[model samples]
Target: MTNALVIGASGGIGTALAAALEGQGRAVTRLSRADGLDLRDPDATGRALDALDGPFERILLATGILAPSGRSPEKSLARIDAAAMAEVLAVNTIGTALVLRALPRLLARDGAGKVGVLTARVGSIGDNRLGGWHAYRASKAAANMLIRGAAIELARSHKGVTCVALHPGTVATDFTAGYPAHAKHGPEQAARALLDVLDGLGPDESGGFFDYAGRPVPW
Candidate 1:
């Protein structure tokens, strides 16, 4: 039986991704803040995954934080609050690192699985034509690096497991609620695309970044 675990599974993208994975006949496990598996807490995350009873065939870290109370994308660099920046980094970058750190134990040593994380196009340093969202951009950039580094290490030790970072485009979610209507995709559409990319992943294709359409995203 193929079991899939989805962290941050309560949000629009996460919930949609979980539903899609379930529809594909994989046993799905949903971890969310409401479920008490806070990604920001490494110990809590490790414990939650360990409690799943078996190794997951696929693990998706879909957690992310964009804006905080009293903070908006409209704010300039000088106005960027340290608290909000730290909060975003903790969830977006550090949280992912924690998950990767726990993977050696959470995954089967036999290695026949994949791990994915939802990154954003904005995280692409080469694609950053317009400069704004300093904290979010930096946090996601760090996430991309972590994903790549983890993928390389996993490839060396766990030959059957593929790890890749994905850009889900601008999805119409609470995280992107501030975005204009023309700049967003429906949750279902984005989720479907992400699943497609994941389904096609192989060990040889690991440590790469791709967009929602499964095309290679330039680093």
Candidate 2:
């Protein structure tokens, strides 16, 4: 059976991705805070991954946090709070890095499997013109860097593993409800596009960042 691991499986994109993978006949293991597998805790993440009997064919990091109640993404740089910014970085960037650091053994090698992280287009330094969500943007940009660096290292050490960062577009989740309606795509669409990207990815495409439509996203 094709084994898969999905972090943040309680979230919209994560849940969707899990369902899609399962639908394709993969046996998926979901990791979430509720399941006691918090990615923020490296030790816990490592333990959870170790608990799996076999290596995973696919690993997807689909966790993120956006503006909360009364908080707006429209806040000016001067209005940004340090606490909120730290929280954003903690979850979006550090958490992901910790997960990757802890779970390298679960990744399949020799170009037969894939590892993907959900990044944002706003993370693209070259694409950030309207900079408002400083913390989120910076965190995601860091995530992209992490994915790329991991890809390079894995390419040399774990020849079979294909790692890539994916931009799932503006999905209509609690995270994006604050944004304008036109900016949102449904979770299903995002899930389908992400799966397509995964299906098309190969070792040669490793370390690249791509949008929901599988187009290259500038880093």
| Highest TM-score scorer | 1
* Candidate 1: tens digits of C-alpha lDDT, residues 172-197: 98877766754788999999999899
Taken over the whole model, the C-alpha lDDT of each candidate is: 0.84, 0.83
What does candidate 2 score on TM?
0.92
Residue-level lDDT for 48 in candidate 2: 72
> What does candidate 2's lDDT look like per residue over 114-191, in tens digits?
888999999999998888878888889999999998888888878878889999988988777666755688888898
CA RMSD per model (angstroms):
1.6, 1.8
